[model samples]
Target: MEFLNDYLMIIIWAVVLVGTILIEFETSDLVTIWFSVGAIGALIAAASNVNFFGQIAIFIVVSLVLLALTRPLTKRFMDKEVIKTNADRTVGMHGVVVTEIPFDGKGEVKVDSQIWRAFTTQKDPIPVGTRVVILDIVGNKLLVDVLKEDL
Candidate 1:
């Protein structure tokens, strides 16, 4: 009981700091990060032999302050809609035929920075260097059509 009071704050603040930081890493949602920052303030204050009330006050104040200051900024920047995949990006983009494609045979086209296996709907073969648009993706292949230029 006597030993508990002397070291309780230091121990408690250390655990809070480590625990909140672990949760922050797991979540990456900015929810627990403010609490971790607050715990750090308390940890330092407690380690420097601050009183119990002072340690708790610093903990609460720093947590609330950090939360208030950074929540809006974090929401503005980190909460935006995130694109998870680039598969949809390939659609509607223009690419150049890298390998002459027979109507019934597989060929290759260079789109943006990627080379994709390509196929066509026409019976005639598309020559290399012809500009094409990706129409759809089938398995690992890109279904493409020649983009006719304005005369």
Candidate 2:
């Protein structure tokens, strides 16, 4: 019975660790801070032979405390960099279509010394060598609208 309790704590800790990693990967959101604390608390409880209920209580309390304490710090850190990547930095910039972009699918554009996959916002196809204005970023692709004069 005692062994089962310890094993359960260990399992809970392992689950917390895995959950944190998966959440961090999927959304890149800052939600795993408390999960990491819960994992650590469960690990400590297991090592110290703490009872099952005690372990759960400790995990919850520690997780909440750490989350509250670190939320402001994490927010500050995340907000400090307004744009972390070159792609994020180029959302509103103008670019030239290097390849003809079909209305149905993908195309390429050159912006700020970089070539990027781009998509047309209009129904008609945009030809190569046309000037385009980037409207927004959709993942790795740029949403673009052609310049009126190029139409």
Candidate 3:
């Protein structure tokens, strides 16, 4: 009990450091790592016989400084380009209607040697072999439009 009384702040800061590191591992998002660093600062202050409030102030200042200084560099490393899927590549592409598309219903269109369920907003039914333009995808269906002969 006497030993704890003398080292309570040190123990608390050590626990905080371990807790923050565990949280950082669970997320890996650079979120709690700053707190872990701050805990290290507080631990140093505690070991130096600083008062509890001074230790807390050291923790806050260290965490804020590290966050402000390193956030942009971390963001640059973390931000990644989104890769497009095969389905996403089909947008704004041309396809052929393989089956007659009933008005306001689904049909099949062939694009890049692949057959896809497709639909259109046109009032009339699109005939088989009609050239179509893939506008977008809704679920597994392709939203299409009639491709005009002139571009």
| Model 1: per-residue Cα lDDT over 1-151, one tens digit each | 7457658888899899999988888988887998888888998888788888999899999999999998999988887685556787898999999999899999999998899999999888999889999998888899999897710
- lDDT score for candidate 1 against the true structure: 0.88
Q: Write the per-residue lDDT of candidate 3 for residues 1-151, one digit (tens) a residue.
A: 7556449989999999999999989988898899899999999999988877899999999999999999999989988887777789999999999998887799999999999999999888889999999999988999998998823
Ten contiguous residues with the weakest lDDT in model 3 = 1-10
Q: Which regions of candidate 1 are displaced past 4 Å?
A: 1-4, 82-151
TM-score of 1: 0.51
Q: Flag clash pairs in model 3.
A: none
Writing each residue's lDDT as its tens digit, candidate 2 over 1-151 gives: 8788778779778888788878878866687868776878778888799877887898889889988898889888777555567667787788999999999899999999899999976898888889998888888999999866676
Candidate 1 at 126: error in angstroms? 47
Model 2 segments more than 4 A misplaced: 18-31, 83-98, 108-117, 128-142, 148-151
TM-score ranking of the models:
2, 3, 1
Global CA lDDT of candidate 2, please?
Answer: 0.84
Compared to the true structure, candidate 3 yields what TM-score?
A: 0.57
How much is 131 displaced in model 2, in angstroms?
6.1
